[model samples]
Target: MSFYDVLARGDDALDESPRRSRTWNFFSHITCNTVVGLSKIVLNTLYNVEVKGLENLDQAMVAARKENRGILTLMNHMSTCDDPFIWACLPWRYFKDLDDIRWGMAASNVCFTSKVTSRFFSMGKILSCERFGRGPFQPALDACVRILSPDNTLDSEHIFHGLGPSTDLAASMAKNLKEERNPLSPEYKPPVLRKKTSLLHVFPEGFVCQLRPPFNNSMRFFRWGTARMILEPTVAPTIVPIFSDGFEKIKPEKVEESAFDFFTFYNRGGKVTVNIGKPLDSAIIDGFRDEWRKLCLKYTSLQDSNRMSDELKFGEEAKRLRSKVSGYLREQVSKLRLQNGFDKEDSRFSDVNWWVKYTDTKGKSDPSVKFVGLNWACRDYQSNVKIYDEKGNLLQERKDALCGPKAPRKSH
Candidate 1:
């Protein structure tokens, strides 16, 4: 059977469960997903999202299904919420039009450690890679090859959305300046580039940051692998450059505490905007990492310089952007909820029992929860990956499978 078949089985596992329990899984589908759906609807009712550059999306699978031309869709990283937004904004036919449309995502092995996220969000086979595994990374490498291979089964919907940290961006820049004598930054480096005849989504920024005029010159440059991966003798693929604007609303504030700064905007259901930039000029990107590097670096650096203090200086740039995007994202999300045929809210997870059981450094719970050393959460730390055996220091990665005897069912 194809891998998709197995994913179908996993999806069915939850669906097959006796339909009348007060369990997390039961509540998640029945409640959480429903509420999430409703929230999207509530937001969408207020605005109409405009997708200006989607034609740039090389509909690889669709084209291949028709003329058999594979594509590479490159994008910039922003929120975990990007895909669903794209799904909602694009025509239902675009997704349904393709016989095999999968998403290529880079998710941590730990996020899948839970039955919930493991089984649902990442139902497809996982890449199972560490953040910076410089050595041979077979699992991730294999998964990449398999997903890119047109022969792979369509039973599962594979999406590659690497939520990897962009923090290393600054480090990448630091390394470049220190060694190669150049500067750029973000928290993580993208995986090595590989040349293949399949559709791929590349996020140049490595992660999300928004709303500084030079929005975060701190953009982690797109790893050269993006170029090296495609420039190979393999069938050349289209390289699209995507830029998004609404994420600025949820900007990690402190933009400037001044009444006029970034702190002015918050999710308060404000607008969200995503613009897909036109495809990169292949003549400029093909076999030329330096050219590609220069463009991506300059593209971002130009955005971040005035991102913070600029907003502090300018009064309503963020406000204008937010008003436009918040209205748009909500509309897009609502259309998606409607497509899913869900329009109600589920409040079960709100009880907190279903919330992730978080533990911090020093093995304490609440104390370490405060983001230390950086505005970032400690969740991304190696220490965050709980070590099961104190003496051996085995991480949650090496722990036994979590499918244990059902915990004494909590009677509602």
Candidate 2:
């Protein structure tokens, strides 16, 4: 199949068969090494890097490995280089097995826009995900769930038995692979063959937020996809919160021209700090998971339930529960920001709507608001807002196009 076809498959690009190809694995090894090496140079030579609480990461890895559980590392997206560069803080042993390395997600529009870039990122083990299109409900998130809780019954032999060198057939098989049922379904069952798991790193913010001082370290509202990864997996993945600062300085939103720019990396000599918080309390997670399962059964039995629509499946109660879980996870990262000597963001920042409202009211009063990252925030909000006025009349006459097709679905 053509590269466009592969890109069109979205999360299906993460199938294990093609990744298992000897040739593909060889290149992947090289690609990962080169990227990580460059990241080391950037972090160590070009910029001063300070990493704290590494023991927390080490301990979590050990525990996850021992328990055969997946590890989900959540961090704030400060810059484009956060992924590979962040791994620079890790020891050499972590890079020894490329399979053991973290699998991350990247926007398809940016990373898979062309064949060369698509192949490069795929080999680097980055899953292509939709940002504005599918939002959190994309199949890529489901792929993440499977990655975290892989079925062990299908061994190398079973996977490659009939498939030969033709990647097309392999891709077909991977596409047809059985999918896990909605965890909220009463009939939902965990994979009986599950035994192994993988590590996934996510920027739950879903977009970069390069705020100005005092609030620069603040994170956007964590997306519900993170909650899905946590709530749907058969075994609760070890959730680890990571906080990093100074990457914004390394690759600031705006670049100034200078003769020295050619000689130096972006804003050279900036200090980058990465703090790894302890794996969140498993008991707390389990409590949330149990409550989620009970709610699922409760919603499924409701007379008014619309099973086809995700919004009506679990109803408003599920949305609130998911928001609670997602909000709590964001709070953990926020706490790390505070611990690292950054000022606490206003509690209102936790509300997704608060940013848009602030932009429309107080933000519009200040012309410099765009300089502080509110520009992208307002743009994102506008993109997701659906207007019910199919006719031109209301849109043209209304001063504020606040009317939507329907009540806004509560953030999960």
Candidate 3:
């Protein structure tokens, strides 16, 4: 299939049968082990790496297995290598059991540009996500929710129904099939499946943000996509918050160079620290989950006889709930950062409006923003970007511009 075809269908275009095949398992074992072994070598031999609160992860894993709950690990995104390299800190047992390994999300524009790269990341268990066009409400996030929910079954047809290149008749047939299987319908019945608890690791920030010194480790506001995995699952996942430092040094965001420069990985003697925080309180998450169900019921009642999907009908209230939940999750990570000796982040980082302002000006002010949203092209540490309301009135601005050639230079 063409790159455009794969991108249009998202993760549904990729064949996941390899995950269940014995031959593929043998191949994945060798590939995954080799990659992780190399990562351990690079992380330990080349640099000094320290890991704390690993006992917390151990406990969380044990509890999750015992309780039959899926695991969702949240962490800050410092560099591209943060996933596999960071996994190097995990014990070998996690690698031995391939099912326990994490399934990550990567930007389709970056990771799915070609068939080779697409298959590569897919084999690595990374889902192709549309970071820009679809934003948070994408099919990939729904796939994540399914992965975390025990006994939840989502076939390729269900995911790709009416998506990508399809004839009018085919699209209509798919739509009809979907309606026939709608959970809200009294006649609808789900398939019986074995309970499988999977693990997913997400960078709730959604993009890399290696800020300048004094704020180098600061995280952007957590996106609401992570909230869907938290609230929509049948059983509440074991949420583990993690904080890491020094991956950025291993793969710093160079202004004039590619972010994935191979030469950067050769650098040695950097100190890397990974802190795994305790699992979030189930009681607190249960409270939020209860609130979410109430909102769903309220919204569903207000809908017409031909009710819209939860994605459509939940509307503003659900959005607000997600924002709150995501903020709380981010706060937990921030607390973990503080425990790891980093200074506390500014309170404004928790505000959704602040990020919305920055995202709204994405390509308009800085052409470098590109189709995948913000990159490291313009890192304005000194001033806030100009913020405007929907009516075009200036809401906020600083002495210096946010991006472009006119933006002020870094002060050392």
Query: Which candidate should be chosen as best, given lDDT against the real structure?
Result: 3
Output the lDDT of residue 66, model 2. 82
- Tens-place lDDT digits, model 3, residues 238-327: 999999988888887654444336546845798889999999999999888877766644443211212324543247787888888998
Clash pairs (backbone) in predicted model 2: none
- TM-score of structure candidate 2: 0.74
- Cα displacement (Å) at residue 284, model 2: 1.0
For each candidate, the alpha-carbon lDDT, in order, equals: 0.34, 0.65, 0.66
Model 2, 275-386: lDDT tens per residue?
9999999999988877765564443322322121344223577677778889999999999998788887867668867754655463655334333422333423322232
Encode model 1's per-residue lDDT on 314-404: one tens digit a residue.
Answer: 2254333332322232233333323333343223211122222322232243342222122211234322233333222344543333322
Task: Give the total clashing residue pairs for model 3.
Answer: 0
Q: Is candidate 1 or candidate 2 better by TM-score?
A: 2
